[model samples]
Target chain A: MLVIGELINGMYQNVGKAIKTKDKSIIQKLAKDQTKAGASMLDVNTGPASAQPKDAIKWLVETIQEVVDTPLALDSTKADVIEEGLKLVKGKAMINSTSADDDKLNTLIPMAKKYNAQLIGLAMDKKGIPRDRNQRSELALKIVSACMEQGFPLEDLYIDPVVLPVNVAQAQGVEVLESIREFKLLSDPSPKTVVGLSNVSQGTKNRSLINRTFLIMAVGYGLTGAIVDPLDKELMDGLITAELLLNKNIYCDSYLDAYKKK
Target chain B: MAVDLLKEKWQNKVGTITIGATKAEGGTRASTVTVGGQSTLPFMFGEGDMPNKPVIAMEIFDIIPEEWPATLKEPFKDVMNDPAKWAKKCVDEHKAELICIKLQGTHFDFGNRSDADAAAAVNAVLEAVSVPLIILGTGDEEKDNKVLAKVSEVSKGQKCLIGDATDKNYKTLAASCLADGHSIIAESPIDINIAKQVNILISDMGLPQERIAINPTIGALGYGMEYAYSIMERARLAALNGDKMLSMPFVCFVGQEAWRAKEAKGPQSEHEDWGPESTRGPLWEFMTATCMLQAGGDILIMRHPKAVEETRKYIANLMK
Candidate 1:
């Protein structure tokens, strides 16, 4: 349960507002609460939300580190913003993105390796987010190869299979699942598979409900990590329960303790 | 010795781990204890050096526990009411080399004690015992951070293990340990990939591999302990085979898990042919601990004094 807390990103309207106003309080609170809630790394994304994206990212990273010791997952589409975030991050942070796109790879992988940061490479190339299992697997391999070429350890690269909304591509969920399974078999030493868990349940009523269901399913398919909202007790609970039942967590003891606290 | 084939074949080194920080290293403990750095399997000195022997830490609670079985209750009696006394008994009577104090009361679902309360309990135990200490947070991420942050700050300069850095909350916990100069136990649900991932995540925070301990989460006998054992054995193999990121020494929480099984706690009347509660209880813990030890566990956290005593004798015999 490597919970990369998703609460600090711009995609959320409240966080976006917080970013625009230079409201350190809101960002600080999010960092504290998420760390308290068990986020290993707080994902900081100020994409298109701040007047000065680079500066805001830097401030968020610095402020969060000041209050808590948790690592930051510096997230942004712009390489420059990520570079700025990396500069401010005290320890090696994770880059939220790179893709099979040659340009994105050429720009981000070198930057990631240079900063000693782990990378989350999206399984999307110039073709954009794949709609089929074959394309998804192919893109993952391409991204992994690009990372290896840049001398990044396979362990340092986390491959996200670009989870799409189930409503639009209902069967694509199965494809994504198959792709994750296939990706694990591609190499003896393969990059870990992470999913933007919320993406699978996008545009659904009771989004947390769907997100959690999909998350459990993803974990079943060898999904090793996730970028999700740690505050979603239901989803977190589901993940904890799944880990226990799968015998991944010995003794099935932590669930009671985990649930009561949540 | 047939030219000592085992020595010739086994060349992997599991790094050594020393519990407690000495005064020269900046801690108040009377002395430090070391384990691991084995070049071969347990007690195979004919092959390679077992530089440091395995050590045991007795598990006690910050608050009096209500959910424990009556058999467990019979051992500590009133002392369980006081963590310091309980911890002292573990060190003095049980001969535990370390004490693992679990702050179960701070859980949001438990008494929900404040961070200050948990810190006071931790400090009290540290003051009472000369042995190295391991402080565990209530499993609630939010509460864990609040309490563990306080523990880390309060216990600064003492190289105690502040657990359990999970994938979700490792960064904050790892960072806290890094700043405070303490060791951490990085716990991953029983998967090699996750174990590797967490090690990487903690290391990314600039914490050295020596300062981190990995817990792959153990299972008791008849409760998937075999799976956990295999995972741990494989992890140790990977490390010895040279996976730098997965090479840290490992710890196992044998007490918390072994005592939870039905064989250990279920009514004796229900399984008359099985045996008395006293016999079955310690046996369960012993079997679980033994399984993990063979799988390369560097540290074991135990509960029953009898089990701990039995395990010590077992280790002594194996070493000889």
Candidate 2:
């Protein structure tokens, strides 16, 4: 299970407050707890909470790395924030996004290459997120081709087919999973497939259960990882179960250790 | 000739797995049995040499199993109460090339037995049967670890095959097997991708490639066997076509799956077209085992002695 801890993002009120106040302790604590909790990568996002997202993102990346060795998934909508975070990161990190759109790819891919960072390419183009598998698959192939043209290793490119909320768009999850399956068939040395997992459970009553179930089903269709809160036990349990079912964890030997720690 | 191509170009060589170490090696078994090391598909003599034929293992229980059909129950009626005696019957009468002793007692619903009980059962069965042994856990994660860990320790240096390691429980079992120098059966639920992933995980833990057997769970005839067959075929093709990660020899649990299905155990009166339970049960196992062998199964774990006899005959005929 490749956990991309969601705690450092500016969406949460405390994290938002920390970004505004420039409280290094809050950033440091979130990073420390998430890393200690076994997050393979911590997501550092500074959205509208920061008047200067580029500066805030740089601060989070630097502070987090000071305490932990786990890699960062530099999450941002603004190119500047992503660029600043990528520049400050000491080692190879993951750029949380680029889209199938030529503009985003043109800007972000070069920065990713310059920083030697892995990238998450969302399955959306100039028209925005596709609602069907064929469109999603087309967008994925386009992004993958762009990455290839830019001389990126397929392994370094993660395809996110953009999971929509299940309550609002029931068919979207299945379509995305199908797209991922189709993408696996097309790409040699298939790029890792991931998703914004919380999108599937947004506004749902048992959000954790919904997210985890969808994750397992997605994994069955060849999803390699996801951006999710590592602290959610149900989601963690589902990941462990999916890893076992997919035979990614051999005999579930990791579950015993996870269970004991939990 | 095609043989020249095999010698010069084929990359798919099934690793030879020798079970049970003699005193000269490290363990205390009278002899060892080797399987795998096939340079071509099963019985494809014209394509390449079949360095070793698939081997048969009789499945014996550590405790009297209540769920087994009457046909199986009748054969071991006398020694079902004793694990050692039961194993001896499987080895001596069945002429089993290997013995698979399932530790079912560890899974009782009335709580569970201590690890020592499992260890004792393993030791007794090992002593009773001179043929190489395969130890299977109870399928429960925590309980299996407790029992399998103990069995691994007691059977150390024997070079046994310990498993049914699913993704959930592979780490401890793989670690235990690694430490004990025993091989393992990496069982997956009939998906080629999963089979490859599990193989990668086990290999990542530093277990030698020769010490692992992939069990891409086979279904009995009339029980989605075609799907299992296709998955195994695909897995074999991938390995042969040079996917180094998936090139391990395969093991099939033919008996456990075959007899458990309704087609094998139902009364003849209920499904007259299916024939008698006694005949259908062993035949189901035999046919399933044979199909898997043709699909490149390196080891078959069978329940009934008749199934073993029938399967051995089929293998011999194919080889001839």
For candidate 1, lDDT tens digit of each residue in B224-287? Answer: 8999988887777656654556667889999999999989987688888888988889889999
Off by over 4 Å in 1: A1-262, B1-11
Lowest summed lDDT window (length 10), candidate 1 chain B:
B4-13
Summarize candidate 1's per-residue lDDT along A103-190 as a digit string, tens digits: 9999999998899998998988775678789988888888887877778888778888888898888888898888879888766587
- Error in Å for residue A138 of model 2: 36
Q: What's each prediction's TM-score?
A: 0.55, 0.55
DockQ of each: 0.02, 0.02
Query: Candidate 2 residues B85-106, lDDT tens each?
Result: 9989987888888889988888
Against the true structure, candidate 2 has what lDDT?
A: 0.83
* Docking outcome class, model 2: incorrect
lDDT for A262 in candidate 2 is: 19
> What's model 2's TM-score?
0.55
